[model samples]
Target chain A: MARLSPEVTALDTMPNSAATPGPTTLGEPTIDWDLSIRPVRELNQFLHDLAHNARPEMPHVRILHPNGRHNLAVGLQVPANIEILGHAGYFIAGMNQAAHITVDGNVGWSVAENMMSGIVRVKGCASECAGASAHGGLLVIEGDASSRCGISLKGGQIVVGGSVGHLSAFMAQAGTMVVCGDAGAALGDSLYEAVIYVRGSIHSLGADAREEPMQTDDLKTVADLLQRAAISADPQTFRRVASARQLYHWHAEAQY
Target chain B: MCGIVGLLVKKPELRRELGAWVSPMLDCMGSRGPDSAGLAVFAEAPSTDLLRYSLYDILAQDVWPTVLERWNANVDAAATLAAHGQQATLFSTTPSALGKDWLSNYFPHLHCFSVGHVIDLYKDIGHPRELIKKYRFAELAGTHAVGHTRMATESAVSPAHAHPFTSGEDFCLVHNGSLSNPHSIRRKLERRGIRFETDNDTEAACRFLEWRMSEGDSLEAAIHRGFAELDGFYTLLIGTATELVLVRDAFACKPAVAAETDDYVAISSEFQSLAHLPGIQQARVFEPAPEQIYRWHV
Candidate 1:
């Protein structure tokens, strides 16, 4: 239970507790956009326009009253530090190139789908497919993730502080995933080159996925992800799960 | 895809604002289901013997007054009607069985959406943004409500196909996904002399669960039996006289989020619909787990 409630290290860089508009004690100017007053289209349009002309410094943009709107801060190619003050909707930061996004509350499906690079952190639980088909970047969930947390991973690192639901990381082709807590059924299925480390119980393994002996490199990898994710789990307690390479080749004798 | 929303107030004073709070939620879900919409509201019973029947007619929106006057003069004199467009609520001391027969015999074209002492159902074939205004959903007041917007994946788009399907007294259900085994379940229930209204899959699930409850099983027990009986993806929300219930299928592929606070409990297919909730920033928001039963009593 203690491991599941790991501290979110993203708070260190976030604005003060107020996180309101205007300059904070950090001296960084904040731009406020309230969804209750303005429409989501205006916010996305402004963010999209800014993506073309890259700003020099870290423009601290604050969005309030998200009310679960979809596609907020998507296709971001800038280095702007954006903070969402409440719960958000699906695809909050899809196709994110190079931006630092911090969600203060829970999020809907696909927080950072197909991200090429950058960091997105969630302070609360996430729904299904948290980081599906991401080619690059890092996603950190400080709480439990629902089913298919990282399904069909294409080269992204996902660190889940708590449990992940069934069929997580299905048909993964690359990258790594670290679960500090329990994993639901079918941890990984038909994996290719993607690696998984679970510190707690695994309900079951999917087809072609098997537990392998943890090596020195595995320990180093888990240690690095845990350190970066701000989770307090020991590297030595995790078990490695990877593909068995049994389903890579088709055999005529195999029964359907 | 479809959309589902349920709200239950914990305080008595909050009951008056139930419609005001839930109207925006239904409008937010208009994007998910643009073809049709439906809502079921649960309020306090006027009396133990009083039954409220929601009647609908498509031929004319103003037919409710004539139907009400005719029923008052011919069927039950003590019965009163609160008509709203084509949708009308008949309040009477007559039992539901006799009430159904009376409506069927006299007004053959009028459809009975629901019959209960606390539930009032309104459904139509249009986007939620349009239907909410047409049905005057913002003026209603209740302790709890469950609403649905349908996309009509495999069925015809009609008011009857809309959700919040009720089978028994003071009970209604709405679903967010499809069922693969609805025909089989319908066949099984047909053998037990259960009649159906439409070919939609959600109605099959609604009737099955309500039938299980009629056989002396609690809603929780009926849902457990539903685990083995119901197949395919679903996020079901049910509203009763005194409680609101929610559940998802084994896969839980269909999305549903719940926001809970000291004042109320709200459930929706996505967090966006619940963004307007009170104390939303401090609400204990979380995704409901698959095959789990979450219930809140009024």
Candidate 2:
């Protein structure tokens, strides 16, 4: 339950701290293309180590990989800007915080699960549960988030620029979920406390959920989140759904 | 742990009878939580001063008036109106209540109060339809409600260990997922004289919300606070008399989906369950933002 620093670092001027002596741009943290690189795994390991030890003053970094590999930038928590030039598998930057991680290409499942703080932007479409059980951070999926994005979340914001698969937010405890497109079924089922804002027609509202009229306060909140997510929509156009407080007790007959 | 459903109409022009609309929606989600079922209705009472409480579980075939009198004396509740606009009666039965005839029997108590009906709780050892039929539940109704189907991960199976659990007056919660830091939070709450009935993580959530509400925070704000304090994977839905909220874990471990139509709003474990809902004009659905919250009001 460590709190992340609220200071935000820009995406340039990062340091290079790879284990291997690889080529690096002078002063700037971008990858040095001059050196003939080693195995993809070795290069990924070097880059991961570099990212973990990157200087705080340096704000930006870019890794250029010609081949698609597995487990790139695993456990990257450095407060710097990072970019991967090629595709990756499994967890890339899983549990990232502070660093603004950008994938130049596609990614595998669970891209940024358990992200405590900061932004993880996926440039391409992601696999299932892209940000599963993350806490206190912003995950921006440029494409669709597969099933269970932002499930069982404690806090933070996930803005999917596109649509999502089914059972998203299945057991979400608290956080704001904003889908620019349509959501799959059973959204917010057995939810404890959170707000869901959708701009399109809902397939169905789960049990204990009801449609609520938009008010000034609600509009303001939605507008703020849209601004942060870089989504453009009239706040008035969004419809909100939440639980109706009916099933709060078990009677003698209902007692099993 | 349980399934809950109900409807809320903001305008006086909206139809007052809620059973026809909310019942089907509740039944549709019966699979999410089957255990047991019960319904309660609340509205602008005819006599504003008379605080009428409808109790569902009482000694079977026993004198209800006597029980009510004793409960009133214990809690200092007085019978203000002998006969009023609509009689508020309590209905309860063992097993699950599902059939059409059994459901209709509960209609006698659902006069004017039948408007804002809420099947606030149900908990048992089986699926939703089985519990519904076993207990004769089609008669239940409500406008705003929340429910749950328990997988029984952290808590045991019992009526007390159900969703739509309450912590105080006007606060209810239904949760999916587990709470890792319940003991620390629970100890703090207990020190403040907050009593807890169940050992499940959902009650911890309810207590968290109640504490926030008691501290002068709105239900939505209290839920927001929970996002920071509560750890582990969880998808939570909270229901209050005036508002509804949904929160997703920061990692997005569980699943939840929602659809809003002009006439009806539906949420289910899968999108297929929402297929039967009518008049779907335009749907904009998405998952909750990791570690974020969504809230709406009536």
Candidate 3:
């Protein structure tokens, strides 16, 4: 954790040492935007203006004093590295594209909803509907997530390091959800092509959901996802969940 | 939405600063619930025979003298009283039930918000700023405290509807989230001869737990039964004289995070509320699991 001195101001340049170490950060400059003195709308306005501005390179921005306020960085398109210091509220990093955003604290409801691309990481737990109807990107939660984690997920990959509440991955169409910890009731209800991997107990499975044997390729995929999400777990210990395909085509034999 | 916060000091030296630390924790959740706010603080018990009851909505000063006169006439022991704005705290050597009976039988309009040896409650129908201005929360000192800011979801915004609802002696509960089947549960409790003060679902839940505890069940047992019977989303912070218990519903629609250190155990609706506490950076912070009761004793 990076500790900023109280006297440090926005004009005082601080290196982004708190972000997760990655290979891409070779020589890029990291900018710090402290939200304690400034309003939340400033960050949103900066991100919005960044889309039209012709900058030579993508900026790495660090945010402070998240204080559980809603809509911190809602619609960002630039491929910037953004890190929030404390808890944030709803719709954080929503509709993100080609950016890497990390929250150091818990997030409120509907985090990363309808995200198109990029990586959104939460170091703490998230409230309901974590990644609803997302197309692409990898959303990682290091802590528990509440109900409807991946509701109506389209093609995004979500990895939860801790347990998830009920109705997770409900009506998920595409992509995969990996839970290193337990999952609540109705793990995947009305699921489609998306796959779910759980290492811990599942209270109950939802409609048209069943456990499938993990193949070699599935293990590799789980391992890859865990590595990308920066979670440590035994890939072989996970059980795969997918659609039973029983409700794919209507049949008179499948009577009510 | 509603915000609930609880702080239980484990170290004796930090007891005096409990209220100062908790005031900011409650204020941080101002956006979650802007309608009304309340808090219950538990300090050292004054005496074994002395029972303290905090009352609200007393319009005139004569009401207290009349009640004290009537109470002294009925009971052999005399009572002492103090007033702060519309609220009053009365201390009597009589049994708690006797004091309650006197209030109910004589002063039907006055609301006894809390009745216990160590618990003193302060609440009002206003924002957190107004609550702070009316009741200097930082001036209070105690061992443990529970605070709530309610965002009128189930009932109207009023002082009586404010949270930290009390049913048992030295016990109060603040809740975040509405119950799906509170009316049905209220009916069952009403049949058991339990009286209710508000139409709030959290009060219904509090009364139900009180009834369960009265029926020879422990607090943990009563909470487990609540998990099985209660419907809808909730994250409840229940405070006793010496304990603070945190319980979340099965679905956990409401947010609750708990942080514990060697000096204190704190719970809030969000981590930001606990961020400013002393030594909170190194405290163990995590969200309580759904349907699991976590208790910390003083």
Candidate 4:
């Protein structure tokens, strides 16, 4: 594995390093292994056992499984780049922190659950309940994502290029959920400080989350999300959804 | 992953001439199918031929010989071909074929076929370009073709597991996505006397199409049936004698893009594969509508 040089780190920290072209300093520092195949159960067990006894030095993990494999690369806190070659089963690269993970193929449900930090990118589509209860870090789904993304999101950002399933951002706390495509029903149900910005129409908003007027702060957040997700779209075209105080702490009086 | 390219020339003499243009298109998608590469080229069927069958029947390996024997004895294929004015040829070209002996021994039906090269399907991944160059895949000619690069998950990765898999017949299919309902569909198709060699969702798709055709459904109608019945995320590209069809699953949980040109149309899992095709004055590129089917005739 190639080590990230101190000079590259210095350049990344500098404010005016944009003049240099090509190869941004911030991708996976190293990637180990080439194309190879392993059974689903065997690969899952290997990743599980490795996560338990993983050392700091093992910073790169490459997996080659085309068929969906459930529970691959769960509960790892090391700083590594785990790349899954093809479409994977549920909980792929789940509960990840410090290390970055990339799936060259599509992913199944609950990707990056309870993740504290680091990045989880899916080059293809994602199943429902993606990024459920995630605390911090960035979850980028290049393709469309199913429902319940960032549900109960305590922190971090989730940027999806394509349409999302129903109940997205349900019961979210502090954080942001950006959808470049249309969002499904019950978007941002009973939200707190978390902000939901969608470029397209919402099927239906949840209990307290109403259509809030787009503000300058909301625009800035949406712009940042679009820039990060690599989707070249105008930020002014989006709408914001925030919790309405009317439905907060629902009691007998508010019962309709 | 391996790459496959074929062109349907309006005229017979133009068939062999299409090799130059078709090679690059196939070479471009080589990244999708890297294990083994092949082109199943077909000349125009004789105008008078009424019945032609491309069979991809998977049974227990032990029952294969008996099934073939029964099929050959029960079916009067030569008389049918003569009545239709169509000449049929079959080739089993793969890395495993040591010599022409394998062809003569197993398939006595085929008279002669030109087999200059066959690329090693195993021990190869992430080397699509090198493999294409080695096999001189650019020189092969055909009217319509399908190609696949195996990323083996449910099935073994071997020459036998390669894509553009026919039912040993004319129908070919290339698929991108998983089938959540494989077990149910496989069992149903099996009971209907359909054979399955690979456990991949793609094989099921082929069998389903064949079964529909057998039940007297048109190619387009069979595809529509597949869209409604099949489950899971899929982007299916199917090629038959007269048309090329692209179908996306209801959810479209995977990626598939199509680019239509004045002279030809290309579809792939990604855009880079079809970017360089000729006469693409206005690239009509878009994602296939969810649960919608698109068909192009040759």
Whose DockQ is greatest here?
Answer: 1
Cα lDDT tens digits, model 2, A1-256, are 1111121211223323332333333464444211124454554455456555546465455555422344556566667667776444457677777767888655556777888887788776565677777777887777777766666766767777777666666666677777777876666665556667777766666555567887898799888877876778788877776655444554565321
Which candidate number maximizes TM-score?
Answer: 1
DockQ of each: 0.75, 0.02, 0.39, 0.05
**What TM-scores does chain A show, candidate by candidate in order?**
0.87, 0.76, 0.87, 0.78
Error of 3 at B177 (Å): 1.7
CAPRI band of model 4? incorrect
When summed lDDT is taken over every stretch of 10 residues in candidate 3 chain A, the lowest stretch is: A1-10
TM-score of each: 0.92, 0.47, 0.90, 0.51
Cα error of candidate 2 at position A199, Å: 22
* Model 1 regions lying over 4 Å from their true place: A1-29, A252-256
TM-score of chain B for predicted candidate 3? 0.95
What lDDT score belongs to each candidate, Candidate 1 first? 0.86, 0.57, 0.85, 0.61
lDDT of 4 by residue, A123-147 (tens): 8878767888889888999888876
* lDDT (10s digit) by residue, model 1, range B32-129: 99899999999875666778999998776587777778878887888889887788899988888788888888887888999998999999898998
Model 3, span B115-160: residue lDDT tens: 9889999888888767876788888888899999989977888888
Q: Candidate 2 chain B: minimum summed lDDT over ten consecutive residues — where?
A: B108-117
The Cα RMSD across the true interface for model 2 is: 12.9
Please report the candidate that would top lDDT against the real structure. Answer: 1
Q: Which digits, one per residue and each the tens of the lDDT, describe model 3 over residues A12-55?
A: 23333323332233344455666666677877887777678666
CAPRI-style grade of the A/B interface in model 2: incorrect
The parts of candidate 2 lying over 4 Å away from their true place are: A1-143, A146-256, B1-65, B72-77, B80-126, B130-141, B281-283
